[model samples]
Target: MRMPYRVVGGTLVAALLAQLAGCGTLFWPERRGQIEGRVDPVIAVLDAIGLLFYIIPGVIAFGVDIATGAIYLPGGTHAQVDPATLRPAVQPDGTVNRARLQAILQQQLGRHLPLDDPRLIEHRGSPEQLAAYGLVPAA
Candidate 1:
């Protein structure tokens, strides 16, 4: 048995239209948890390209991504301080002095930090372990 040409054509058209829409949501479904944040530039560019080629599909893409929360960057707070710079915060035992670490971080960041927050992660390691990461303990 052979399928009708109309049926095959219609199916192709529908698939193509869906393909042209919502690249962000379709491509990065894992980014769905964030409700709001800076828009991901790569995704924005892709959606804009779709918009440039076809208005309806492009608009649908943007709408779908925004609605699904896939258009925004991951939302969280994190900081990267150089291991060498943080050496002063490490104790001889390789544990960080919480108060001293907080003061160091606050001074470097020029802001108040809740280092004592139980919800935040605090790392403890041996002096040798810390040395592996370039964070040598004080003598």
Candidate 2:
């Protein structure tokens, strides 16, 4: 008789790969309260059962980075905000509208990068403007 477990095992491995391939959004830090209804129950059950092994540490690190006011998520650096979008956040009063800046930056980059982030300071002010604010631009 043919080996029966090979068929079952192969199907399980394929399903697992498919589930992981689609989990990109599920792990993103910005997906809170929005991404929903697409879970594979099999994967969900497997993940739930194995959560402590790897997922818990990742979640804890995400939480700690959030508490620290980090500009990006914990894994790696993301691209800087486009200077085009950053330009308009300058208000008529000549101050950066930090609230507006935060919203735009979050939408464009999926991270809460601050206007004063080093990556952003050059985009925000001319040399004279930065001096007026008692700030210096990096070369």
lDDT of each prediction vs. the true structure? Answer: 0.73, 0.50
lDDT value, candidate 2, whole model: 0.50
Model 2 Cα lDDT, one tens digit per residue, 39-82: 33433444443344356533543343333323132343547766
Clashing residue pairs, candidate 2?
none
Worst 10 residues of 1 by lDDT: 116-125
TM-score of 2: 0.30
Q: What is the lDDT of residue 18 in candidate 1?
A: 52
Residue-level lDDT tens digits of model 1 in 1-139: 3568889888767655655653887788887645567999888887776676668777878888777778888866666777777877776655678788888888777767777644343445666876797665756
Relative to the true structure, candidate 1 reaches a TM of 0.41
Error of 2 at 96 (Å): 0.7
Worst 10 residues of 2 by lDDT: 31-40
